[model samples]
Target: MPIEQGSSGNNNVGIGNSNPNAMLTVGGGAPLFLNQGASSTTPFLAVLNSAYPTDARYGWAFYDNSTNGNLDIFRRNGTSQGIQFMSFNRNTGDVAIGESSPLFLNHGSSNSTPFLAVLNSVNPTDAKYGWAFYDNSTNGNLDIFRRNGTSQGIKLMSFNRNTGDVAIGESTPLYLNHGASNSTPFLAVLNSVNPTDAKYGWAFYDNPINGNLDIFRRNGTSQGIQLMSFDRNSGDVSIGTSNSNGNKLAVRGTIGCEEIVVKSASTWNWPDYVFSKDYKLKSLQEVKEYVEENHHLPEIPSAQEIEKKGFMLAEMNMNLLKKIEELTLYMIDQEKKTEQLKSIILKQNEIILNQSKRLEKLENKL
Candidate 1:
């Protein structure tokens, strides 16, 4: 609660500029605190100025020396001799809030050393507990930081250099280039899963005929490859030229599991899962559940009895043919729509031509 201002031979009771002779000015105006120690130094303000804990055990202070540059903020620990938090480079221009170093800079064990280094940008040291984003102005990129178990993390997606892209690993990483969206693109993606374990995840970039996107993994290395391609005319599945390279190859042999069937273009947004909305069984569990819940159970059949109960091979073949017919019908419907649109356009063109001719005859008669 008590404040002191020192000037030369006398000390002022309340806030005011220190007299030219005072060694220190504790309160506001001009040199907030002018220290006239034989080595007379401009006074600095300590926000938590009390001898013991002020409001709480932690305390902070701010100093303003306009003659040098601008106002500055500083914080201190009860036992420490220097300010633990402050604004201003002791070696550079005067410390000013919103002037030079506007935010609180915590001085670690080293004197005047900044705990966090921000270059040409507004930086949040820590956000959402451990998330931090650095908006670098000089290079024009955003650097996002997240505290992992023993390290800092970042998103390594592609970005635009002209607009500013972020590097995945380092805080001060350079924003190099743009991505598919004509912005900064990422060169790589780092996985969080264990590196050695086959079950752990992996990531890589696939830059085929079109653009680049990261491919992630869960089980096998052979399956990690991604094909960045699409059929332009039919909008069917087609891998890009980059994907055509044997490098993007997936094991073509009969596999243990069924290959994922992409039903529609919009399905890319969701993780690939077995079956679509009309969920038939995706796994054995689903199959059992459906049989138990939907069908009336007769007594458990013996091996010989089961053979008689099961569908005949001919019946299975017919069901398979029916599915093929359904798919064929769907394709034919799409083709029909295409033909219909073309016919409508042609008819409109003929009508326009006939109308033009009629108008020409009327003009001649007039």
Candidate 2:
């Protein structure tokens, strides 16, 4: 080995070439190598050491004695020495960015702040242009933030792994919003086509004026033909504006089903009051007179009224039952009167027969 040292003030040392600008330089095709003895406490490479006892010191390529001789970066502050900023598992090749103990690749851990923060660092005033990931200790959720030059970044999204629910643009998202704007917050699903489809498969539109959420399905190119709508303010549902013309579960086409059942609870007011004794039953004569005057049964809606306003089936059925009950009462009264009349005729006939027999006996004597 040949060594050439420069003059006392020049402070230059060259191994193969002379006139070196650096303090130490090696020339030729040979490579510079450093060999260190196997020690868990010593570093293989060190850049700069602290001159004073109070200054903070940094080093690279240090062997960690705590992690079973794992290679790591060391940062020292005063008498305290540790791998405070970063650590690496040489065997596993797992790098921890801001954690002393990394469980996985790119693992970040902190106590009072975000576990991971990616900063732009291009401009200090607008330096909040990045992302942050942290656990929300307040709500016990995983929150992801998007920085917009604010002190605390805006929470753009969250996820609850336990419930398997992901929230976007809101802390607690019941549903997802595609167009998350203040003016128009809606979602649209488009159909796939060769030349690009103009038809929407489905769309959810938010109506701020009515406070309704309108869901639309595309029949053709007509967008926002409402299939259904939910009113948040009044809790009303509108359906089939897109398929049919009416509201509240309207359908254009015919529906085929095995059975359609409508259950009316007992709390519903039924028309059993018509059968009560206090119910006023009109006489047959009065009913006939009324029918002749009005050309319709009493308490029944006329054809003209039915045409004007649709009839309710339940109400009409009750009215018809009342009329039937009235007819039954009339029949019972008429039957009793007929039986009494028949009895009187039979008694008169018997009396006439007896008088005839007595007259015949007098004629025979003469």
Candidate 3:
């Protein structure tokens, strides 16, 4: 016969270890209430390797819904739990499984993929940095999760952990190359799907030719302009070098203004014509008729005739040598027939004057 200890130290109720603390608190004649360790001397159980049991041993004394075992993941020494909850062994830290333990996994409880899994097979140190990956799924891609160093959560792309650089989109997208310097300005490539060819993308250089950040677009050809800088603030521009004093200077084709205003001929002369109400122009047909009626040219000597006069003037003692020489070159360029016509008019005028004089003399004789 197995003799068991009972409560009520008087009258030899025969409870073993009559010390009040040693007699485990029994509810309904069973030891299952905040008293798993009441029979033992230890106060709390130890956890090893972040797991309850070191090895795969599992066991349970007893548990009921009314008990506090389901309250928290871990509890203090004096907390209430009617059952001897499973724990790691004091030596190897493996779990101790009772013979009649239930099948925990097949208990119809929800147990699927875990919410977080960190495998640092390469590095064995602690996860000293913040969260490296959140919501990392099983898609077989290299992924990272990011967080603010402080309380605030992640602001931008969260899961990019390439050092000395930052990347976005499916393994790589926008790459900011500050690998040269962690603190200073950096270079970047945008919309880059492939780093080898860098197709359909642009490159950027911070603190460019004359200390200006330059943005360059690439297509079949490449074109670039200075965007901004610590020294100069210009958009779509190219900056020149500084003088000995180290001041910013504008290069050629870098205008000061954002846009240039071009004016048409009519609008440019608006001040002169501002008061006019309307402008008028006759049609092409009217213009043709007017020109036909009024246009006529008087008969003139050829330029050759005028040049001959220059030669004759020298012979007749009328022209100086300098004048004749000047006229010769002028005649070559000017119209010659017009000059000949003028000479003919002068001769006719002299003949008319002589004839008039003869008529007057005849009248007086009569």
lDDT of 1: 0.39
Span of ten consecutive residues with least summed lDDT in model 1 = 120-129
lDDT of each residue in 1-366, candidate 1, tens digit only: 445443333654444432323334434332333332321122243344442222222345444435444344434454443342434646443222332223323333121122333222222232212333334344444434443322333433223346443344442232233342312123323232122223323333333445445344434442354433333333333342333332333232334666655343442332222224453323445546766775622222345654675543344444455445444555666799899999999999999999999999999999
TM-scores, each model vs. reference = 0.31, 0.39, 0.28
For residues 1-366, could you state the per-residue lDDT of candidate 3 as single tens digits?
A: 222354455222112223223223222222222333322322223221211221222222232213322211222223332234333323332232221221111111111211222222111112322333333244222334332333222323323234435445433356555542212224445444333243445556565455556554544233333333334453334443222133343343346788665445442322223123462333445546765764521112235655674233223322244334434544543557677888999999999999999999999999
Q: Write the residue-wise lDDT of candidate 2 on 241-318 in tens digits.
A: 432223345444466899877667675556567567897778788989999999999989999999896576667776
Index of the highest-lDDT prediction: 2
Note each model's CA RMSD in angstroms. Answer: 26.5, 15.7, 21.0
**True-vs-predicted CA distance for residue 336, candidate 3, Å:** 32
Which candidate number would show the highest TM-score if scored against the true structure?
A: 2
The list of candidate 3 runs beyond 4 A from truth reads 1-163, 180-197, 207-209, 218-236, 239-366
1 or 3: which has the higher lDDT? 1
- List where candidate 2 sits over 4 angstroms from the true fold: 1-185, 188-200, 208-211, 241-278, 311-314, 337-366
TM-score of 3: 0.28
Error of 3 at 44 (Å): 8.8
Cα lDDT computed for each candidate against the true fold = 0.39, 0.54, 0.35
